[model samples]
Target: MDLNSVYQRLNTGSKKWSQYPEDVLPMWVADMDFPVAPPIMQALKNRLEHPLLGYSVAQDTLRQTLVEHLARRYGWHVQPQDLVFLPGVEPGVNMALNTLAPPGSGVVVQTPNYSPLLSAPANWKLPRVDLPLQADANGEYPTDIAALQHALLSARTFLLSNPHNPMGKVFDREELQAIGDACVRHDVLIVSDEIHADILFDGRRHTPVASLSAEIADRSVTLMSASKAWNIAGMKTAFAIIQNADLRERFNAGRLGLVDSVNALGLEATHAAYSQGEAWLQQVNAYLQDNRDYLAHAIKNRFPGVRMHLPQSTYLAWLDCSALDIQHPQAFFLREAKVALSDGLEFGEDCGQFVRLNFGCPRPMLEEALARMERSLQPPA
Candidate 1:
């Protein structure tokens, strides 16, 4: 319940912490700073009691847990046989691109997306057609339907990020339905990354694009995990739901020995997360919502030069520093403010003036990072 309490993550092989110097506060990575859910921890410990850590496959229980989870939570009914477990979502994305999209074909993606999703097309020798999300009068970044239709003309696949990253814009049902209908009309394959599906804000329910209808499900591959929601990313477990039998077969074949089965402990943690971590998830969601509000308020009142919008989901805030006239905002913040944020250049070349701040840590850490950033902009003494 003590969401605001800070803990030491340094020297623990944490990518977030080790990315920068010891003095710099890391607000960059998607992984939360909170401890793993008690259920997950206990499950892992229980699994370790066996003392035989061999390469493992998911048991029936794990598959059923995911199937039930999809039905109960998202109203997406998928069979147990349709599940394919993988090491992580990145591998799943690459697998989908490699197998589903033909070489030399185009892959349509939304701009200002997660770095991996933006770059995955190039990994398979596929051309990437970027459709930029423009902010409308309501301050919501809506997908340009006309642009999407045009992009799908040449592209064979669409990589979607529901409850999007960096921007944290949750695609509403109408938008998703339109997107699904477009894909159907254009005969395009749909590869959706719904990893952040469970981390929504403002009473928003995550609707998987594949769940819109049977037609959409037939052409969709949904990648989801409990990593972000339950703080079990270290487990490196994720699964893909492919309803189409042929597509599922081709995707499983695309693993190419590079994408191996998940770890034993990771499987245990995942099962616990979906089955027994509901209370913990609710508590964390509330905590993250509060942190999101706190960060937004701080940015508005204390840092007038910086601009941000409240993200509908996820703990990341895309801070626009264009008004500040800072040439490289990420580097400037790291050097002057001693806070390490995700460089916007990674998301997109044109986003160099933007920085993604992760507020999934304790409240004190969030406050301290903001304070340091505010002080960095002060005139020299």
Candidate 2:
């Protein structure tokens, strides 16, 4: 699939490339620098041949494809009707919060989460309760169960990010079970973003929180997408699995005319990705893992002042630049290294000294970014 090949996205209205100047290397946004999978492109091309691009609905075939995908890949069996198509996961989250959660109720979210998940509660006038995930001695970010339970006391919804963003921590089955059980105990609805489910590294498996048991399924809204894994973010299609009929109905109601139906091309691309893009995905995963390892090694040996934990999933790396004495790492890299990265403050208020680097690019690009960063940190002559 030529995973290492870099395409020029400049002047193509790419969010990643257009965010910075021409000289700057953008490693900020979650989107990849690689081309879309051939299967997805072919599917889009085939759909275009019909000569009609009107408003569309997800076909039964697409639902069946998703159903088979969940069962085959994650061993998570779900009926076809359980799926609710959305334009994007962010809207699904806001919809769930706006309709399901009571007014002024608290929504529990882990700190240092994706910016949208961190802010969705506020969009619906719901209070946000922060449950911080701390990194232990091994540099692994583990959830604090007791804290989570305590936070749930004031909250009716838990916004979860599995194979989490920014930090890239993949929650194991035991951890998900504990979380679901706690939610069940407190009657807190789980709105989980499993968008990066297929992007795991090192033989890791993604477990949908609702997949743990029927009890969890009844209280969960699992949001997923083919965008992240297949490098088709522009398609803007994602789906939510709501096994509980009543909850699904309420979630659909929350769309409120603002959140519209998925586009025609997105549905076709999504079906193609799940049904025929596995081979392409496997190669991408391997390439990302190597890029991750290379980045970790470079940070350790080349930049002693910078620190980062190996991300278990996702192509994003959360780098701690606290030791570098930089007041704002993201801005520092952009100004000094001419490299644009996601600002840490967007993820969490206390994350100002941190920066998230997107490594889903060709090896040469990754190396070039590292080289620029290393040079930026050098002492003046």
Question: Which stretches of model 2 miss by more than 4 angstroms?
Answer: none
- lDDT of candidate 1 over 1-381, digit per residue (tens): 678778898999998889888999999989998988888889988987898998899999999989999999988899999999998999999999999998899999999999999999999999999999878998899999999999999999999999899899899999999999999999999999999999989899999999999999999999998898998888899999999999999999998889887888899999999999999999999999999999999889888888997899999999999999989999999999999999999999899999999999999999899989999999999
What RMSD, rounded to one decimal, does every model reach? 0.7, 0.7
Error of 1 at 37 (Å): 0.6
Clash list (residue pairs), candidate 1: none
- Model 2, TM vs. native: 0.99
Off by over 4 Å in 1: none
The local distance difference test score of each candidate is: 0.93, 0.94
By summed lDDT, the worst window of 10 consecutive residues in model 1 runs over 1-10
Candidate 2, number of clashes: 0
